[model samples]
Target: MENATPSRTALGVARMRALHQFSPQAGLFRDPYAIAILGEAAPAAQELEQEDERRQRMRLFVASRARFAEDWLAAAVLRGVRQLVVLGAGLDTFSLRNPYRDLSVFEVDHPATQAWKRKCIADSGLAEPAATRFVPVDFERQSLSAELAAAGLQSTAPAFFIWLGVVPYLTKEAILKTLSWIAGVPGSEVVFDYSEPAANRDAAGQAALAFHAARVASVGEPWISFFVPAELAISMGELGFDEIEDIESGDIAARFSEAPKGMTNNSGGGHIIRARRTA
Candidate 1:
């Protein structure tokens, strides 16, 4: 089946991730599928590659959080979690990484993104863990719960939901709908990121986001949401989450930065929250 076309930013982000992993200086993060996704399995080996400010910034921000997510996923498995869901999975190759061989992994993304990723997986002859599954969905035209149900998801099963770089693109109502659905799945904990209003207004941050958002909007995928971490916590509490732990973007940088201690980069926007539905 032809994957539903994803927004351009999805492609851009995928390519950016691919580029970063292909670079020699790109450290701490190891993503073998990243280069293959860009069809650049042999990106010329170099010392200190010239970097586009926007791409460099995105790579660093994405890289840091990718590390964080991997770390968290490991802990989740150790805690006896078996089901894992990555929303807007993009070119993220964690499923390919197979960090947990015993876990059932599911990737949810726009049909096009999933298609491109699948093709990359095939073209590169890279192994996709047979245990992992893919569900393609278009927010404009599909239902997440329905898609997952078709994939054999138990609505009441406890699961970890990784929602990176997606919440900001969804409408508030849609975000709430997803959370409510996740809550319905007993013991589900959601880990996702959302930006602050200041980041939206800051000059560099605004330009960076606008650059990506324009392409997203051009594809009829306008970002209908921007969430404040604090307000989001309150909203999630109201939505019935019994516990919520939030990590700010800056905090993520400080915690997992490979760029060196105190080598400040200000473009990281938003927070990743782990929320457990209590009610």
Candidate 2:
């Protein structure tokens, strides 16, 4: 990871997902094309599949959040949401697997990561879907609204956004600005994950947190923001989101109660939050 790129983490997530497909406890979600997209790099990625228990736990959470987000997207489409914006899209396969022919999937990510994903798609011999559009932007330097508009996103339409693996790395100001912007848009709902306030964690939790924190930081992306759930609820309410549902590990476990005995749910990790702007 010397020339570490954010896209590498995305690949890591994809590899984890590929491993999950073969797990005996697997069925929370399926991505038949994940391994295929990795192509030549897959054998090495597969080798790391059994590296450590902590990594396995991380993978489970990654896959679980993805499954949860995709489930919500499907539900949103049913409710007539025609636009899907994937912030920090990375290697997500939702666009390719999309069953809704009319749904417009906009993938917004850093230029380098977006380029890499496009190359992966090409190498896999999979043509990018006509309904899928890629919008490249530096999250800290560019305007999301401008980028999306340039990519043909309709501001007036109801949209569902999936923002995974990006929030904890962003500063609080950036997070609030993005949330406020999303709230300003009519009929928009976003699902993203955020870490709990580190100060609130127990000794054991703090140790686990330090381990993972060091790992990401070593790769040049550190977790800089966390939220207390109650405080986050207030923030969302103030920002104009009519509905907010923050799903914790316990809730995720209960939703997928059939998970295998070995599957680990790290309560110390982050939780997924869904916020909607109805008016």
Candidate 3:
């Protein structure tokens, strides 16, 4: 999150996605551009083959969340949603692989990260879809609503938002504010992931959380928010989201991925949720 520098965590997540490409279980959610998008930074086959339990769990979760979000998005498109806004889009290839020709995809991210993504895309020789619009806004300094509005996002129409790998990094107030904005769009839907408080986690989960927290903090992006599932669901309901699907960690792999043999689902307290504003 340092000024003028792309997020290190973003790059790390991208690497995980790249590693998943080499997974035999990739049929669950194939991202052909996942490795190519990273250009030279893509993980070597050796790295993919030698992944430990923790990294394997992380990789599957990342892929599962994307699968969950996109499955919901396909349903939204059928329901007449045209706008697809990717909040905190970090080297995500959804826009490139979009099957809905009419869907307008918006990639929203920090200016530094956005710039870096553009460079990577260009260097990788991947053609960005014409419908993909990049909106650069530093959430700390700029107004998301204002920036999206100026970038041709229709406020009057419903838009589907995919906010992944971002909620835990934001304060509760900021999270509510953003959700409130999404609620204002009639029939809007959003898919996002969040983690529960350490207290709610099992002993093994807490140990994993501590390690990951310290790692991210060392890179200057310490997680600042954790939500209890029921409380977060209530808050979303208050924001006008009538239908909510909360998928816990244990369920994610079963729901999305064809787990590799002996793959233990040790995803800790992470959860992926999809909320809809029907009214």
Candidate 4:
């Protein structure tokens, strides 16, 4: 997916979050910057519609999980975590709307995507936050630690990482390398989402996965890796995480607002996991 245009999936995700803003009241979470980040492409993004029922379900999951991650980050910040690192931060507006006064924010993504996002920010006439730093990185070609350090990230301090919309697009080895590295840092906690293996899915869920998987593959960033919830928990334990909270889609829906009509919050499709290293 290197040297490709900014991910279509990213644009779709941004659109989903932007739609949440229009929901009655504040919706799952408020992000006024979500639509602005689309810039001149806002109308084009709005015009891009999901023609299939399964695709619509997939879109709801995107917004739901984004809400989940942001809520968790807010709680983490309340506990005195002063740093936030966002991985694969495609069109994410958390940095722009960050409410914590003392928190430092970092946005990490592919160079090409980051460049496109910068242009979008400039076109929107929104000033980037002074505390927010962007680190252009290709995980396969460079070291995340080295890149973050070069960008002024403190390795010795506690930090919270928000990793969403990128795990399933990566390989098992790549995911492990990144997670293991995070575990090595003291007081590091990461909240990320991942798809469950097909064996765990029912017939309808499996069909939905097939449709969504094919759609992403067509865009060059296919779903390459998956995990069983049990196996994933064990893997995190082996990696030295002192605490692991595995939340499925159904749980997420119940914890948040009611699901809209025809919205299928299937846990078999994906999960949001938070792991923390206290030692």
lDDT of each: 0.72, 0.82, 0.88, 0.81
lDDT, candidate 4, equals 0.81
lDDT tens per residue, model 2, 157-241 = 8899999988887889888998998888789999999888768787755776888889788767778899889999999999999
lDDT of 3 by residue, 51-167 (tens): 777777778788889988999999999999999999999899999899998999999999999999998999999877899999998776788999999999998998999999998
lDDT by residue (tens digit), candidate 4, 1-279 = 657677777877787666556544236567778777886555333433533555445556677777778887888888888989999999998888888888999999999898888888988998889999999999777899999999988988889999999999988999999999999878899999998877789887787678778878897888999999899999999999989998877665567664554453573477889999887
Off by over 4 Å in 1: 1-6, 22-25, 41-48, 198-222, 261-267
Q: By lDDT, is 1 or 3 better? A: 3
Regions more than 4 Å wrong, model 3: 261-267
Q: Is candidate 1 or candidate 3 better by TM-score?
A: 3
Q: Is candidate 2 or candidate 3 better by TM-score?
A: 3
Candidate 4 residue 176 C-alpha distance from true site, Å: 0.4
Which sequence of candidate numbers ranks them by lDDT, best first?
3, 2, 4, 1
Tens digits of lDDT, candidate 1, 123-175 = 88877779888999875568999998899776776688888878877778788
Best by TM-score: 3
Residue 66 miss distance in model 3 (angstroms): 0.3
- Greater-TM-score candidate between 3 and 4: 3
| Each prediction's TM-score versus the true structure | 0.84, 0.93, 0.96, 0.92
